[model samples]
Target: MREPLFLIGNVNVDLVMGPQEPWPQPGTEVIVPESEFRVGGAAGNTALALDVLGVDYRLIASRGDDMLGRWLAEPFGARAEAWTVAEGATTVSVGIGHPDGERTFFTTTGHLHSFKLSDVLSQLEEAGDGRVALLVGPFVIPALLADYDELIAILRRRGYRVALDTGWPDGGWTAQVRTRVAAWVGHCQHVLVNDIEARGMTGADTVEAAAAIIRPLMPDGASLVIKCGPDGALAWRGNEHVAVPAPKVDVVDTIGAGDTFSAGYFASLVESSDLARAVTNGVTVASLAVSTRPRRYR
Candidate 1:
């Protein structure tokens, strides 16, 4: 039987510049560019990818009682068993980029600021009787991290395996956060990290070097995936490693590419529990995502 997957994270509105030049310095006026608002966020993007892969999964996250929130929620209502609209506005991210897809982000916390771990626990408790796997990352509320140890303990006790994606470290990473989350990774079954995140964790300059640094740190059963965009992705299990190139395709927006790959990998796991196949699926999906016009969330 296919196991049920659960994604817990942020859901936000994305404002993307259609055609923009380099950002001007403070007090320097820049030419206006086309823009569009769209549904995005790690939560929504991951869920959308899983949905597209025809996986049975539930997305648990907080949204606001505003238009952006509504737009984020509509797509998942059919598949989501329970979703909440907290008493605030949904988060928004302004992305400035060129036609070639190199971009920068300016974000506002908005409703995601109101997220509480208790709310997530309540939703999970309600989910009931199924193999629940969680794909977590850094874009989530800080409160979520604060409760992670407790949460992972509960999920493990409940017989659920956890997959972790330590999203980009902001304002630089400190030993304290790394120690706490590292301990948590020891308890996880899988970890999704890029060369950057791996380097942060182990202080290696390259992905291969970072992978070497990460290999011994992973728990007894954990698989650590090092995702290098376009170059390819490497899957590590114990002392073994395999590099799989991403499928060839025309480049577009890379936003949410990692999340989409996570979804595909997780979906493959739910279906077969075969690590190699899961990694291949991730590459396939990420290729599909990066080849599209502008941005493709799933």
Candidate 2:
């Protein structure tokens, strides 16, 4: 039986525009010949990726009590009902990509900021006695960080191992963000971060250096995973370090690639507790994401 995965974070509707030349400057229009809409958001994207990979996970997030929220639910399939509707509009992101499939995103987080501890606790109740894996990402609301200790305590008491994905630190967090984030790292079982985020968190110049710095901050047995885009990923469990290679493929939109890798990594763990295999699975999915035009799931 697979361990149940619980994703706590934002939900958003994505507007993707493809093949724009040189990108657009402010007040300028670049003709995008292709466009697509998908279910996205740090939390939702991971949960959706897990779903596509046939992993059992429940997404707990705030949606707007509006049509956009209704639209956001469409891609969730059977998990649609798990969304908690708030009083505002659903979040949206406008993503633009180059011919090489590199993407830049602009977003409005919307009602995602409204999530409260009550919602999270209620969602955890639904996981029952299954081994729960909690995943939290960068876009979570600032105020929610105030509940970090309580949240971690609850999950730990309930036998859930937590994983945190380091996202861009919001300026709104001011000086307190790093401290709060460090507290979470100490409590979570694993930390997943891209090269940029890892550098910011650990003050390291390279992915390996960042991993080394992050390793000492986490609990003695906790794991640190640093994603290096086309360069693949490096992971550390205690003193052992492993480099997992990404499969070679033609470049496409890298949007959601990291999140896809994370889903695969955690899904592999739920399927088999092997750390090396989990890292391999993460590389596989991330490679697939970058190789496809609009992203494809395995």
Candidate 3:
């Protein structure tokens, strides 16, 4: 049997509001037709997706000792091993989704920045052999960013199949951040990035060009997958490149679509070891995700 997946990263509560026609102006108020409160963050969304797929996975993250934290933990039960911190309130993200499917976020970093490498290492030791360790939201967590190199080395040394999703850096991409991201990609067995992230990280104008540039940076035999929002996704492994087209559907809210795609892609890859099928699974899942209401994994 394949070992359980270990998903490590940010955990937060998402307050999604929208379907508004035009964005509200600065210093003005506009009410949306709909709003929802749900569990989110890249790690949380991925874990929820895995659950919907009936896959066994463990979520490792930090949460604040507050009502929101308790609310978030209630759903995960035993699958989540979250460290509770008393220093601040749990992370909360206010997501504004426009009618055109575009989204923006106002977030509080909260306890996400408090996750320590030592905590992660201890979890890995407990996870034992052959498990897949997915490090999500690397750049979002300052603690993870500080000890990323050491953490990757340790996971690789312990025989874990490491997958990384850097997410988007807080301050748009820069030369220094790009170089650091490239270095992190070198150590991962599977690298996941959105089209914008791929272009920024590789200085390539197109998904194909970006994938080509990132392919060589990954370790030998590794794969890089770039998700193109409406166009679909592309996977690159060595000299091979495969493009999977997404199904056209009415998009509701795209808040956690990418993270859901990551869950589907990784789950398929782990189950079948087929790159082409994995990309198909990812696109299919993401298509379904975006067609539904925010926070509904299935």
Candidate 4:
């Protein structure tokens, strides 16, 4: 049977455009070559990719009571029917894609700032041991961030293993944030982060060095995944360390690539529990995601 997996985080709207060569001056409207409107967020991207990969899961998130929320929820269909509704505009991210799949984003806080642990608890009943709850972008959710420990305690009480994927902090990664992140790492059963996030969180210069620092902080048997774009991914649990390489593919939209990797990794991990295969699947899926235009996760 597939492991019980659920996601907790934002499922906001995303507007993607560009690959334009020049940075236009202020007050000038620059038309880009391509654009798309879709659902996105670390958890949202993982949810989309997981759905495509045929994984079973629940998403504990809220949608703003607005047109954008309605629009974003369409792609999720019945899976979105139970999500909570926040009292304002839905969060939206504007992604400007650049050459080689790079991107810059302008995002609004919207409903995410108000999402809380109460919302999370309402969606899930008491689960059996071994259920995995992937919590993404905690730093962006003000209410959730403030009650993180309580959230963890609640999830543990309901028998779920947390997998934290705290996306970039809005206030930048200061020393205090890093300290808190380390505490979260020590508490979670799994941790997923990209090379940059890993380095930034651990104050380590290299991905390997960062992994080394993070591995010791994790609770016994917890998995630590460091996604290294293009080059591939690495996973360390206790004394076991695994590395996987990614295939070369044409550059396309890089937005949500790391989140896509998270889906791929956990989807495979749940199926077989093989660290090597999970890492390989993650890199392969993410490689294909970056190279495809409409984004195919399988």
Clash pairs of candidate 2?
none
Regions of candidate 3 where Cα sits further than 4 Å from its true position: 25-28, 82-86, 126-128, 294-298
lDDT of 3 by residue, 1-298 (tens): 1668888888899998887767667999897888889999999988888888777787878778788988888889875554545367888999888778887889887878777787676555643476778889887788777998888878878877788888888787898888888888888888988999999887889888888788888889888889998999988887778899898988887888899999888778667878999899988888898898644545
Best by lDDT: 4
For model 4 the local lDDT of residue 97 reads: 81
TM-score of each model, paired residue for residue: 0.90, 0.90, 0.94, 0.96
Error of 1 at 17 (Å): 1.4
lDDT of 1 by residue, 9-71 (tens): 877888877556655788886765566677787777787787878888767787788877777
Q: lDDT scores for all predictions?
A: 0.75, 0.76, 0.82, 0.86
Model 4 residue 28 CA deviation in Å: 1.2
- lDDT by residue for model 2 (1-298), tens: 2756777776788898877777557997666688988887787778877887888877777678899889888777667686678788887888887777677888885776777778777666633454655556544565565576787778777767778886887663334766677777887778888888888876667777777666777887777888888888989887677798777788767777788889889888876767788888999988887787557768
The Cα error of candidate 3 at residue 126, in Å, is: 5.4
Candidate 4 lDDT over 161-194, as tens digits, reads 8899888887878999999888888779899999
* Candidate 2 Cα deviation (angstroms), residue 215: 1.1
Displacement of residue 212 (Cα, Å) in model 3 is 1.7
Q: Which stretches of candidate 2 lie over 4 Å from their true place?
A: 23-28, 126-130, 172-175
